[model samples]
Target: MGRKKVLAVIHTVAYGKRLLEVLSLLEADFRLQVVFTAPPHAFGDDVPAFLARLGSVVLPWAQATRMTFDLALAAGPRGVQYIDAPLITLPHGANYLKRVTEGPNAGVAGLRRQDLLPGGRLPAAVVVPHHAELRELARDCPEALPLAHVTGDPVHDRITASLPLRAAYRRALGLDEGQKLVVAVSTWGADSSFGRFDALLPRLIGELPAPRYRTALLVHPNVWAGHGAYQVRSWLARCGQLGIGIMPPEADWRSVLIAADWIIGDHGSVSLYGTLTGAPMLLATSSEREINPSSPAAALAAHAPTLSPTHPLVDQLDYAAQEYRPEEYAAIGSRITSEPGRFNRNMRKLMYGLLGMGQPAHEPVTVPLPEPLPLNAWAPGHGEVSA
Candidate 1:
């Protein structure tokens, strides 16, 4: 039989990367087609450019909308109006990253919280990262539940799977045997570590002992697009001149995480995911203290030590290396990482079920398909599904 044609739509680099990784698992069974939507906001202009660096096939939106396919997949809501096929939403930022302290505007300050569906844009299947996320979706957009599937973030599957590639990645970076690797990750905005560090490369070179420590950078794609790639590249070149290793925007962050001994970052998913590695994380912003007490960002901030330019970097690193506890970060890990073999299986089950194909090879998960709940179950005085 011919493979099913699947249209994968992406608008942001983060969503693009996560959806790409998940789609890779279905390669043998699906004939994948990709479409890149125009950037919707200020930082978006860099998305297609960033996707190009990753060697992705980005169809023009005009052409993408005209194409026909059996299944459509996306990580963002922007795809809702474009694809005619049964839409599947594999949301990009499963962990909430945002200005939670900022009242209504507190929804993921950097990127749109793609998981929350609008009143009328429910997809055929919305794959969420965890049960808490599913609960969050139900509370906010229960209309999407009938189509929701509680599969852990597919990116976590890629991250856990990349653990074995660490040594190879280190070698590719030409690391010496004994040097401790410190990766400073900068997400976009003035609040992030990249923005906080005026002379980031120099500060890192000065604070971190060279013979014993090596520093690398993973700047967010939005930063590149926002600041202009030429300026970002020029800065990276300056960093390279100072003997700092830098990961290009296109580099898989999981690879960097696997090689990192410590991570210094601001409020973003990189920091959120870094916590899962049990590495002592130093946050560059104090804004995290203002995040909603019940929000995931606040949960992460409970453990991350705030970093300041004047703080003693080496002393903190040493203390963290010795005192870091994996158990403290386990809650975060549980939310992101799935049961080892469950992600692909659940994806296959969902796909096959949607396509009217036969049963998938994987066994059923412990949680049964969720029943549509009353709005009162989560919030008082709200109505049921909007349709």
Candidate 2:
């Protein structure tokens, strides 16, 4: 019998990377076709060529393709209308932060209403990151519960697999022995944690004490959208001059996440994902100004230290480093990511069962990963590694 045809639609780099990671493992079961509903500029130049090497026939949403697909995968609501087949909504990020306090249908998830489904039934299943996600989906869209599956995220699987390489990652980033690293991640917008860093950076750089503490800035892709990549890189260059490292938008932020001693960021999923590493976390309380303070990010912050520009940044980091709690971090990480090692098997089950292809005995494949997309990294005169 011929392999099933599946259409995978992607927009953001996060979604593209996760879906591709899983699909790359299922190359033997499915004849894959890809469509990028997002603008070409939103992606790096390497994407198309990378997909081509995987034997994917990239299709433009407007272009007519006579081939029929048995199933379709989309990371967001925007990609839903662009594909034709039984749809599966596999989210790009775990929406745990905004939903807990604001309810399930807040932030990026509000658009993914059950009624939006074609014929209100095409999405045979909704692949979620964890049990918390399933609960949120049930509270927000109960009708879609039967279709939901807690399969976790492929990225989480990849992140878990990369845990043993911590030393190698730190080495690649050029960290000297005993040098403590702090990674501050921003999720975009003027209200994001990254925005608060402009004034805070000087104070942090002045107080953190050079030879002992090293810092890195990770900006979200939406920031690149608001202020083009070049402009964002230029703005980040100033931070680099102060002996801070800049994490390029196109490169995987996980590299920094695994190596950092403590993380300082906003309510973005990256903050939640950081908990998985069991690292000490300090969230920028400024994020609560725009987003709800009672949200999951705030809830997770209850477990970590909170940072505000008005507060003593250095003192807080020292305190958090000393009094970090592993149990609390593990509890939060469990809620955001489920079945870490078994994600691939769960994904295979969901896809095969939903597609009515019957369960096939499948094993994970080791594919050669490409180099990081060519993004301009900021390297000031200081001795800092370029991400």
Candidate 3:
């Protein structure tokens, strides 16, 4: 049989990152040729550079949709229905948490009824992380429910799989014995942690002594791509000077999450997914208007302690841990994904089935999360690595 071609529709840097995780299953198989494209998106800034860094050949959005392919995969919904191939669409974030602010799909997240059925068409499959999302799809886009599949979350599997290496991860991040790593994460937009608490990183740096607490800032890739890298760096210059390590947009954030002793974050996937790392979590921000009330992200906001920017940062951190309940957080983790450690296996089977080909003759591997990026090095010294 001829080698199959796959088109990966990367709508943004964030989606590209998630798509890369799913694509890892395809790496060992030499029978497929995969190309990429960055459809027009507000956060499509760093996509070409990101793909170029990987030495990936990309076809322009217009040109790519015109041609036929064996399969097409996308993490976000942006001009995907036009692609001429059997398409599989996955959520960029682990849960369909965010409530859409505008457009025809407003009030709901990006998964629009029209997106699921653009002019009486449906994607070959819609992969959701949890079965609960199937209900959401049924209510929002019932016609697309039959096409929905629950393959589980790659990020959920990776974070949970790396828990045993937590100590090693801490060491790689330069966290000495007795030092706690406080990772402050934020999703993009005005409702994110950074938006609600602008001084969160600096507060963590200033209030908590460097010897006892090491601080790191992990923002969504869309934040970096939305405002040019220069602007985002400029905004965080003071925090950087104070030694708050800003994680690179493309870095493996799972490493940071794994090593983290305390995660103070907003209503983002990384924050909610941080529960699996065995680290007690505290909410740095929340947006009732933005987060779906029934979604898992919202469920976390309901359970975890909310960090007060004005209050003593260390005291709140102490309180959160002291009041932590593993059972509650574990339940939240359960909601993130149904199939534990099976993302690679299930995705590979689905892809190969679409290709009408036999299996690779070996067990599909769930690749381990790598060490934290040197660019996001967290230590006592005051240094910065801006993306």
What are the per-model numbers of colliding residue pairs? Answer: 0, 0, 0
Q: Return model 1's CA RMSD, one decimal.
A: 10.8
Q: How do the candidates rank by lDDT, highest first? A: 3, 2, 1
State the lDDT of candidate 1 residue by residue for 153-194, as single tens digits: 655655555566666756655667987888888767666778
Give the CA lDDT, 0 to 100, for residue 324 in model 2. Answer: 85
TM-score (all chains, Cα) for each model:
0.81, 0.81, 0.94
**Candidate 2 at residue 265, lDDT?**
76
| Model 3 worst lDDT window (10 residues) | 378-387
Per-residue lDDT of 215-260 in model 3, one digit per residue for the tens?
Answer: 8888898888888888888888877787678876876678888888
Worst 10 residues of 2 by lDDT: 378-387
Q: Which scores greater on TM-score, model 1 or model 3?
A: 3
RMSD of each: 10.8, 5.0, 3.1
Local lDDT at 230 for model 1 = 77
Best by lDDT: 3
